[model samples]
Structures are given as structure tokens and as C-alpha cells.
Target: MIQNQHLFHIPVMGTGHSIDTPIRIAHLGINSVVSVVDDMLCEKIRQHYSSVHNIAYQNIPKSAADGRAERITAYLNLMADIVGQKFDELKKMSLLEGTEKDRYFRLLPESNPLRKSYDKIASLTNQAVRQNLIKEITGKMTLGSIDVNIMAKVDALKMGDDGQPLSSEYSDASSALRGYANSKLSSSLVLSAGFNPRLYSYLSEFKDFYRDKTGDIKKKIILKVSDFRSALIQGKFLAKKGLEVAEFRIESGLNCGGHAFASDGYLLPVLLNEFREKRNQLKETFQPMIQSFYESQGWEYPELSEEETTPKITVQGGIGNNGEMRRLLEEYGMDATGWGSPFLLVPEATCVDELTSKVLANAAEKDLYLSNVSPLGVPFNNVRGTGSEKYTRELVEKGKPGSKCPKGFLVSNTEFTEEPICTASAEYQLLKINSIQESDISDEEKENQKNRVMDKTCLCTNLGTGSMIRLGIMKPSYGRQAICPGPNIAWFNREYSLDEMVDHIYGRRESLVPKERPHMFAKELTMYVDYINELAILADPEDAEWKKLLRMKKNLDAGMELCMEIAKGSSYEGENLHSLQSTVEEQKLRLAEIFNLVPSEA
Candidate 1:
């Protein structure tokens, strides 16, 4: 019912207020991760944040070239551990100089042929970026026999800066709002990382570098292989991989939820429903390497035996997805529609409507919508930003706001609306809704095709600020019948919890909706049950829903004496009332015998 008791709730960020703390999903951009030398909140997130989830057109930690070989391998492993402790404190005070002097300071050689000529210029810049030549100016600038033992030991000593060097890129905005509050977020952030460029042009321009644009940004590139030196250089070579590209990004307009992110709701119709369900067992089992990136940069090649580009599809417009917004409104046929944050009213927000699926389904607990807007915390504090912004206003300055504000309205989410009842800790709520209506919002002037489909989702302004009080008692309890269909959603959207949908909103089960169609009353099921009981939160919400149903019936009746001390560890994944099963084992038949294969034992 209240979206099946909002799956145990937990989108934290505290400070008083818990009038039964509902939901208010905020954390949009915050000056693109806080700072790259505070270009003044990146000029107000590039002048009042326009959205494609705009992080002022992101490319986090910027300067690419694999961020110059990850800042020259972390500036030569901290200048080879501070020049092996200033060459063992300048040769234990004897101060060794000019070659032939050897025998003196031995602390320097952890096999340093100038660190193998900077690992042969980061392996020839990953072989000229796997050959698409990501602007490769030069190739092997020397590592031949390790530069004769690095110009005879850096011509006998002299490099400084022990704290290392290339220390620049910084931006944290509370670790990008705690990675958008771990989860329960929908107000924005899709990011996905990049740098694949056709496996960086098939291992450095060796041959098929997007084979004469037949590559299509090499399958909309998303080869994200985080660390361990880019997973031992590109996740052990794109690890077997599959699906080369289907990058769909649609929007031909309308998002903040009036719908229209089409191309079958993103993943480009699951990559054309998995290339028409694996076009004939993929050349007898797996070597596909697909490609397709056409912002209409001339669209020609389609012979496609199965590769030249059938599997290749880049089409990026911007998305939520609808076969990438009906394939760019049937390739430029266009109605344009958009309305970000339902033209702003904020309190549990909602409005969404690909045209059906009961959006905001009658926003029940009273159509939530709260962010009157405030967290003005981050703006500069970047110190390389990790552990998700552990709060470093130079290490924890608390109530930030050192500057910026004398120009316009800088405080809103209702001037810190308080109602704090306490039982608190990680308090935060930011509502959403209103995706586009009033006939897909048009203050027209002729730039037709619904003004290029309402210039794809009317660039952002999303709002949020929460401490709960059901977003101030459901923002005027559904009055103004006002727009708000879907903005900043968070009922744990993996499309309402992948199919199980908690046994279809708990009638014990039965609500995927088409059982020969009967469930009446619509307006998208009363705006999705008034945006889930106005984001009603109650997983022990300070008891009283009958003492929280007698403490969930005495904590599920000693839930197995709290699951028999869960193997003595007591809680987290264990203690399920003493039945224990999960040490954690979904499936990994040694993952095909760790790839050597042939291990299907079941």
C-alpha cells in the first residue's frame, strides 16, 4: 500500500525533524562534486544548472589521457617513496654525487630505470589509447632497455618535492552527497564512467579503430574498470565481454516525468532486446563486439552481416528511455514535452507518465513534495573528495556558507523548515514530481517539433530539503491538484522493485496489472497512490501505528532470539531469527572455473 511499506527505508542525512520521516530524495549536483578550484560553484553549476543531470557537463577529475596516466602513476609512486628517502638522507650524510660514487646511498633502486621510463610512458599511453589515437601526439618516447638505467641514476641525484607531485583534481560536495545517499535516490545521477573508446581503439590503433566510424564511439563506450591499475590494465582485457554498444540517451523532450525519455526506456530496448535475442547464437557463441553511434553524423552503413552496425547504435539524445524516446520521435518526426520538478512546488514531488502505468497514482498519504531547498553546505571543500565527502570544510567546518549570496534568492527549501522530533541520526528528505503537462508545457514562439520536443526535458532546477514532517504534511495535501507527476523519485526504483513488487503492493500478491484488466480507479492509480502515502515512512517510525504494530509484533517475536545471535555475529546479514543460511553465495561455479571454463556442476 504505501508502496508496500517502502522497503524498510533508509536515505539519511540528519538534523532534527522526523514527524515520521518520509522521503525527500535530493542530492542533485552541488557544483559538480564541490570544486576543481571553486570556479565559484562552477559558476553556479554552469549558470543555474540545466540538466542532462548536468554537473556542468561532467568528466569528473577532468584532464583525461587516463588523467595523464593517472597523474604519472601517482607522481612516480610518491617520487619513488620520496626519492627513497632523499636517497637515504643524502647517502647517510656522506652526500653521494655524480655516478662513479656508487656504494654510498643504496635506498633508491626498487628497479628504477626512471621507473622504466615512466612505465614506457604509461605503456605508450595504453598503446596510443587502444589505437583510436585519442589525440596521440607521440608513441614510445623511450624506455628502450630502460633508458640505460635511467640516465645513469638520474645523472646521479636531484629530483625534489617528496610529497610527490601532480596533486590537483579536487571536488567532494560531501562525497557527491554520499554517493547520492547510498540509495533511495532518484533526483539525479547516472554517471557510469567512460574511457572505453572501442577498448581505446582496439588496444592502441592496432586495426579496427571504430573501423572508419563503423565503430560508433565504440558501442557508446562504458568500459569502466575502476582501479588495481585499471584492473591490471583494462579489466583483464575487457574480460570476455559481450554487447559492444547500444548507447541510447533519448529525450526528444519531456522528463522531470511527463514522460518521453523513450527508445523503450533506456538501455536502447535492452540493446534491441539483446540484438533480436542473440542473432543466431552470436557466430556460434560470443565474438560480437558491436557498434553504433549516430547523432545522425550522416547515417549510411547498414549492410550489417551482424556487426558493421546492426548491433552498433549510439543515438544519444538524453534519457529516461522510451525506445530512446520513440527513436527520436521516429527520427525527427517530433510533439516535444518537458517539465522539470513539476515547475517547482516541492514536497515529495510526483507527476510521471510515459502515457500510462498510473503515475503518482493518486499520491495517497497525501501527494508528497517537500524541498522548499536548503542544504547550502558544499561549494568549495574538495580535498580530493572521497570516502564520499566525509565533511571536510578543511576537515569538518560544520555549517558552511563562507560566501556567495548577495545577488538573488539563496535560501528556500522553506528557510530550514523544522519539526525535528529526534529519534534521529541520518535525517534528509527532498520530494519531487511534475514532469510536464499543461499539454507538455509550451510557451511557444515557433521553434516547432514541440520546440525540438520541448528542448529535451527542460533543463533542470530540481528542488529538495528534508527533515520529514511528511514534507510538511504532504505539501498542502494534494491541493492545486497541481502538476507534479514525477521528479526525484525513490521508492527504490529498479522499476518498483523489479517484478516481485513486494507481492504486488501486499494484497499478498497480484498487481503487475494485466490479469485481463480489472483494477479500476485510475488517473494513474490516483497519482500512484499519492506518491506512495506522501512518502510515508514508518519502519518503526517512533512506534504508534499501534506502537508500530506492537513493535512489528515484538520484533517478529524474538525473530529467532534475533536469529540465535546470528552465528554469534548477531545482526547485519546474519541473525534472521536464528536460521542463518547466508554466508553469501549467489552463484559462481568458480565462475566457469575462473575462466579456464567447463565447470557447470550445479
Candidate 2:
């Protein structure tokens, strides 16, 4: 009887492929299918659930003498009903959690019995795609070069505002991760590649293009515990992933770090338990790696802090039956951890609801043009708002070499590059700029009013309002298609967006786009640099104190950048690592010159 309740659900890719013309096929219909499924479950629950131990049990148990029997019966019924209904859900969720992909499970609709069961679900998802609920990708690699581009875009927006670059391309839009798209809409981001550093190497490409195009480089941090034997490793990994996501929030950037892992104790507990005699010897091997992230204040000096909320590990029960799994992840503490796949499986059941709909909406928006090209979907950095990337800025500069830029396009690299959105943005002239004053007209009283009719500008306050419709739900809508039109083709080659393609080809990314607020970032930075330069002129070049401060800033940037570059760089091996050190050293000297902090002794 319970077996008959078993229902299979087919998952469909949202990368839209044009069946004929504009009504591109896709996944926005997922909600309807889910609702249908939910309805069936509700009916089943009502029909099969015993009044004894279900929620019904609570009320009856108080009156019933032999409540135990009622509880047991209800519990059994609940378990059976859940098991049958959850078969596909659990299966999908499990696959999402692991690094492995069976492909067969992902393609359940192609078969007979499984296909029949999932037909309705599959058709709905397919309808969403066919309707262009999915956005498109350009197949552009975005990992390698990111920061420079983000920075460039940021700079371009300001310079354009101040007539530094093309005066027409000035957008003062700012964006935040887990935020809405309209207020501070963006089209790209640069960030740490993700947790599986050993697998992907695409960050450099993003870095170069993004910086060159002026996209934001979302920064991420990692803390890992290296003890392996105690099985605490999973916690460490989860911690790193969790913390990395937190760091993105901490830095006012779009949350993109989903791969940072904790490995601090990955090797310690294992060695301590298994090779007690050689524990000291093993330290020799891992110590160098750990010690390099030097903390003058202590082990928790900078990014490696035990003060953070450790990743709540769920895998220990099923990820690993042993006790030592989480301990191993803790050994190598990582701030940035993974959450994308987990969220994808049961977005409704996840604790990370803030960025879920934003990312999905963004992904759906970008999937339009990419449908003819891939199945991995596309990246949502644009709508998510590309972050503080050096290269992203460079890229923007490259695009709008004239000097002044536009306003709405500030946080977006797509406007400056070969993107899919066909928006005809007109740079406003002499924008009447002033923060909303709360004392007189705009206050708590106007909260709802402002959100209702307020023009979508580049302010965090306003953007949140705009995203109200887009967040928390992953279905694609008109907003998603603002940037790219999916395929003009089919599901086999369709990639809704670049981010999706990256995910499909590489995996969940670790990098995130930081916040983009409608403000003068480049102008502000330039002002600060000018003030420092003026101070440098006043102070003697050989002044030791000034040199120290400059050196200090350099050290800070070096450390921050190193973490970023290491996290950002595609190739973390040999010459690249050595080259990173040298690059930082060189930048340190440049900082000294900028601040007039040259070596006094010399």
C-alpha cells in the first residue's frame, strides 16, 4: 500500500531553448509542479495519517489513556508516507550534497517507469524553460580575472559621473549579495574560485576579463582544520564553507564563496591518533603551510578565527557514519564553504534563504541567450552585482575609454562587455542627487510608500525594495531576461547564463560579487589617495614613521590580496604561488611611493 504512494519527479534544466520564437522553454513553472506535488502529499496526509500520533496526536494524547499506541501508529504512518514521497526528493538532495554526479538520476525523464512518474514535473519544468524563464550565458569564462574588472567598472561609473571617462556611461548603482537586482543590478562578479581548488582553474580568466572590464571582485576567506582520523574533518570543511559565505557578507560584497573549506585540523587528529610516534614528524609537513598565514596577534589574528559560528554539519549522520568526519574539516578551518548544491535541492528547506531567490532569479535572467550553447546554465554575477575586482574595473575602463560613464550600468560589466541584455540605458544629465531625508517627508511613515513607487536607483535602501519581487523564489521572470536571451536553440546546447555554464562545467563557485551602492567609489578612493599623497609631500620621503604606516597598509593589502589571489588565482601551483609573493612585494613598494614612505635609512 505504501509502495503505491511512491512517486518519481524528473528534474528539468531551465536553460531556455526557443521552440519557435520568443516563448523560450524553461523552469519558472517549477512552483506550480511543486504545488501540485504538495497538494497530493497534503491529501495523502489527511487520508492516511492516523489521529493518534500526528499533530492530531498532541490534542488526543492528552485525553487518550493508551497514548503510546496512538503515537506509535501515527509515527509509523508518517514515516511510511514520508519515505514514499521523499524518495526522489531525498535522492536529489543527496546527489547535490556529494561531489559525485550519477547523471542518470539527473536525467530521470528519459526512461519508462521513472519517466512516467516524473512526466508532469518534467513537463512543468520544461514549460518554464520553453517560456524563457531561463536566461542565457555567453560561454564567457569569468573566474581567472575578476577584481580588476570590478574595480574598473566602479571607477568608470564615478569617472563618468565626474567626466573622467565617457560622461554617458555613468551609473551610480551599488549592489549587495542576497539583495535584489533592480536597485543595484549587476551583470558580473569576480571571486574566489570555490572550495575544490584542486579541480577548477577558471578564476584567472574572470579576473582578467572582469578587471579589464571593471567588474567587482568579491573577496573570500578560508580557515581549515587538518585532523583527518577523528572524522572532525567534515565540520572543518563545513566551517570553511560557512565562514567564507559569512566573509562575503562581512565585506559588503555579494555572497559568492561556496567552496572555501576548513582544513586546519585535517591532518592533526589523524596523525595524533594513528601515528602518535610520528605526530611531531608530520607537523613538519603541514606546519609550513599553516604558519605562512602569520598572525602577529595570535593564531586567530586575521581570517582564521575560532570565534565564528562553526558550520553546522549535517553530513556526520549520513555524510559519514564515523565520529571523526567533522573533526577533519575543522582541522583545516576555512571561512568560505559550499552551499549552492545543498540549497538547489531543497531551497525551501534551507537556512540560506536570503540569497537563494536572488541567485536563481539572476541565473534565470541570464539563461536566455545561452540556451543554444550549454546545459550547465549561467552565472548570475550581473544581477547579483559583480564586486570589487581590480580587473573588473580595468575591463570597464577598457570598454568606456572615453572617461565619463553611465549610472544604471555602474555595477554591471555586461553594459561594457559582450553581454545579452538589450537595455537602452540613457545616462541622466545633472541628476538631482540627495539622500532621502527622514525628518520631513521620508521616514518610517513613508517606508511602504517609498518601496511602492520609488524609482529603482543605485542605493542599497532602494535596491532591497526592488528585489522584493525577485528574492526567495528561483523562478525566472521578465527581469531575468533583461540581460540575455536564451538560445534561439535547444536544451542540449542551452546554458541559461555564464554562471550556470561555469557551474555545469566547473562546479559551485567560491567567489562572490560584493556590494555595489550608488556612490562615488573611484572618486572617493582617488580623494583618499590624493590626501595620502599630499601628506607624503609634507613628510620627508625618508621618514621612518610614515614609511612604517605605508608598509603597514601594504602589509594589510598584501595579506588581504594574498588571500584573495590565492583564492582567486586559477593556478595555485609552483611559479604562480612564487609569482604572487613577488607581485605583492612589488605592490608594497608602489604603496610606499604613493604614501611617500620610502626607506628612510636608505
Candidate 3:
């Protein structure tokens, strides 16, 4: 496998957290991904990057959308303008002369007192001039070669305005793939939100871009999976459609920020090892199936190169230090590791309100917890004490259950209306609260229901407006900011520059030196234990809860066994290892206590 020079990737944060993310990363000549959920912000960043830096910046923007031709078309049109505007600026810069040209070429010495200030200004001027010169000399402006990969979440694909599945012509995934097909600025389509056969079939229509002249795939498709089974299943499904995934991005369930999709109990280290061992077998099994599919469709089965068929394995979640980062890459053969929450501290790469960033920097372990704040019903990583959370509670105390719901992105509930409504909407929450009060249940249940209703925040606007509030650009009435940072943020106590973060990733420097931090495996186990306790509380005295508990116990047992194996084989012999062993033993005791509560199978 070809190891990337930029071995790290910045995964998609919320619409607000990663606003202008790519532009900042590109300024340092690094590869980065941007969230395109907020298309207007994406367009603005694209325009600014192209105009300021004459070189075509390669960025990946993730789209979580319903299949709308108009929506996809708007993004493409904006992209076209972004590219056109960049070249126009480059053309103007090509004609620079005198002091302007001199300043562009001149490199200020580090010893100069004003070097830092001058270098910042001159870097932009120098880069633009240099790019213009390269274009002039080569007589080739490869505008189309600009990288702009689009990420589409399969499960989140929106239906048409008529409340039907989008037609093939207007299908979101297909349109995005076809829109950029064969164009110089063509972007790869990354399929996320797990596997969907219909989405794969729709993409097969553009076989030309999906597969190259040599039968090798030209366009890249990345699948975000939580476990080996999901990866294998998705890989086989794609191969059956005569397609091969370029990468399998494995994310941790509870350790990540935003939507926390906790696994039944599958831990990260075990999942990685499984993938490492089965990767070759997986590729070998899928290749012929893909070839057979092509043959069945009366198409010539393209012989794929070794690299073309083999998908790179990548992991993200709770990766706090260079030691863990290096181990994942070197030990598991992972191609890339993602850093998301840490970048929130680096204002250069991610958007965070100054107040929110401070809150995150000063946050302790208890401050960051998984909560039912998302309107989507998914458990979201949330900060306990933020302006947004405080505002949400204040409104609840005042008998107002929900926010204004200005941008109705998460409005997909039909609980009270003929048309869909957001659960966090004032209309819906007010209705829900009244119903819960009248329900034939215990007072405890009523209180629990009320708390859940009040917990729902307007994540759509709250997530996007934090940076605007931090920059003193826009201030919403409900709150100034909301931040979603993973548990790992607690270990990193200070803000860092992008360079400092990169240095930490590459082991050049240690930016995060916490007094006490649990091993990643131990941390994951602890999360699972906490989750089990919560489940136990809500669990009924029935077969269903028993079955769930049994499954969880099985997974926990497997995870603990793996932890022991790691401890036995690991070279490190120190306090860290002792802490890991202690944590594992503690989890074992907790698991046993839960297991004892379960009724006997006999």
C-alpha cells in the first residue's frame, strides 16, 4: 500500500465546527475534509480559498442530503464559480511587477524582528505569484485536477418534496457522482451511513467514472463502518455491483463526537485486528464476485491492479497521542488516522466560539458526556455547561420546551402533524410535554419523559452559529454557542496551533501530556460499562432485556479477553500497563455484578 505523505485526515465535524476547515488546512498545503451540510458556508470557503490562494485547493465536503437535483445542482454551480473565480485571480496576479513582484519573491530572514508579521502577508502573495508563474511557464492550467470529494450519507438521503424516494434522475448520490463525472474538477463520491443496495445500483449507471479504461476504478468510494462485519457486508455488496470501495473508515461508537452510534460492545482494538487479519481474504473473495457481476451484465470484467482492489483500513476515535496514533498505523497497517475534536482547539482549522473553545479547554471528564441533545434521537456528545445547554434549560424552566427551529434540517417527525416536524420544535415539544403529563404512567416515568423532551436542543442552528458568535458575526436569541467534543478533549487541556497538532501527530512534540489518562481500550470499556448500567436501569424484567444483557455480556467478555491478550504481549512495562490492567479488572467486576442480576437461563 502507498503510504500517504499526509498520513492524518481531519474528519467532518459539525457544519459549524469545520466551517472554512479546508481553506485553513490548504493554506498549510495539507489535505483536509470539509462538511458540506451547510452549502452556503462551503461555497463561501471555496470562493475565499480560490481567490486568496491561486492554486486549486483540494478539499472533501461531506453531504448529508435528500436526493434533490436542485440541491446538488446548486452546489455544482457554486463550485464552478469558485473554480472560475480562482483562475481569474491567478490571471491578474500573473501581471504583477516592481515592489509587488519583489515582495513576492523576497524571503524575510527569521532573525528579522517583524519576520512573523511580514511572512504571513508575503506567504499569500508569494504562493499566488509562484502558482501564476508555474501556469505561465507550463502553459497548462489544470483547473479540473482540483480535488473536491463529496461525502454522501446513505441512511440520511432525503426523499423528494412529494414525500417519495427521489427519482433516478434526481437521486442525490447518483447526481453528485454524475455531476462531476469526467470533469477536470471531478470529485470522488464517498458513501457513508453504512450500506444501501439501491444507492450502489444507482452509482453503477456511471460505470465509466466508477471504473477506468484499464478496468481499474478512477473514482474513489469510501465506506464508514463501525465493525468488520459491516465493512465486509458493504464491500461484498459493492463488489456485486461491479464496484470496489477505496477505503474502509472505521469509527468508534461511544468515543467520537457528534452522533454517538455505540456498538453492542465491540471495541476498537479488536475490530482493527480483525480487519488486519481478514483484509487479504476479503479482497480475494470480492474480486471474483465483482468480475462475475460485470460478466453477468454483458460488460467486460476489468482486471484490477493489486492496489485498485485492496481497500485501505483507517480508524478514528479517542486517539489522543502520537504513541496510539503510531501504533494504529504501524501495528494494524492502517493507512490514515483521523483527528476531529483536537482540531476544534486549533482555530486555524476549525470554528469554535472563543467562549466555547475556552469551555472545551477547561472541561473535565464529567463535563463531556453523551446526552440526548440531538433531535435525531441519536446520542450526541455534549458539553454539560455551555451557553446553548444553559439556554435550553432556561427555556424549559420557563415552560418553553424547544427552540425556534429556524433551519429545519432535522425536522423528520410526524408525531403531531400531517407534515413532518422536528422533535425539538416548540410546537412538537409543547405537544409532547402535555401528552406525557396526561399519560397513564408513574410520576418517575413522567418526569423522565419530561426531562428527555427538555433535553432536545436546536442542534441545527446551535451547532452552526457557534463560530459566528465567537467571531462576533451573528448572535442568535436562544444562545451564543454549542460545542460537541469527544471525551478525549478532557485530556487535552489547552489550545494548539495546526503545526503543533501535526507535530504531536508525527511524534516531533508532545502537545497533550495529561497527569492521568486511561488507555484507549480501557476508556472504551469504561464507556461500555456505563452504557450497560444505563441499559440495566431502563431494562424490563423480560426476555428482551435478558437477551440484550446476554449479548452485551458476550461482547464484554470478548473485549476483556482481548485486553488481557494485549497486556500480555505488549512491550511496554510501566504504570500505563498497570493502569490498563487495573481498569480492565474494574470493568470485569462491574460486568459480573450486572451478570449476577440476570435471571438464570434454567
Q: What is the C-alpha RMSD of each candidate to the true structure, in Å?
A: 25.6, 22.7, 7.7
Cα RMSD of predicted structure 2: 22.7
Writing each residue's lDDT as its tens digit, candidate 3 over 1-602 gives 11233567777777667655543443222444544454444444444445554646443334334323333344444544554564444434532243322222222223322333333443455777656554443232222222333434422334565677655644444555555443333334555554657666666776543555565555566777898888888888778877777788898988887788888888888888899988897788788887788788787766666876777888888887766776787788998888889888988778787778889899999998988988888888887788888888888888877978775666778888976788889999989989999999999999999899888988777777786665455654536477788898887777887667776766565446563677777777888888888888778758597688778778877888888777666632121455567888888878777766432311
Better structure of 1 and 3 per TM-score: 3
Best by TM-score: 3
lDDT of 2 by residue, 220-326 (tens): 22212222232233223323322221112111011121111122111121222333333333233333433342232143323333433122111110010011222
lDDT at position 343, candidate 3: 86
Maximum-lDDT candidate: 3
Q: In lDDT terms, how accurate is model 3? A: 0.67
lDDT of each: 0.23, 0.24, 0.67
Which 10-residue span in candidate 1 carries the lowest summed lDDT?
A: 144-153
Ranking by TM-score: 3, 2, 1
Alpha-carbon runs more than 4 Å astray in model 1: 1-168, 172-359, 363-462, 465-501, 505-508, 512-602
Candidate 1 differs from the real structure by a C-alpha RMSD in angstroms, to one decimal, of 25.6
Clashes of 1: 95
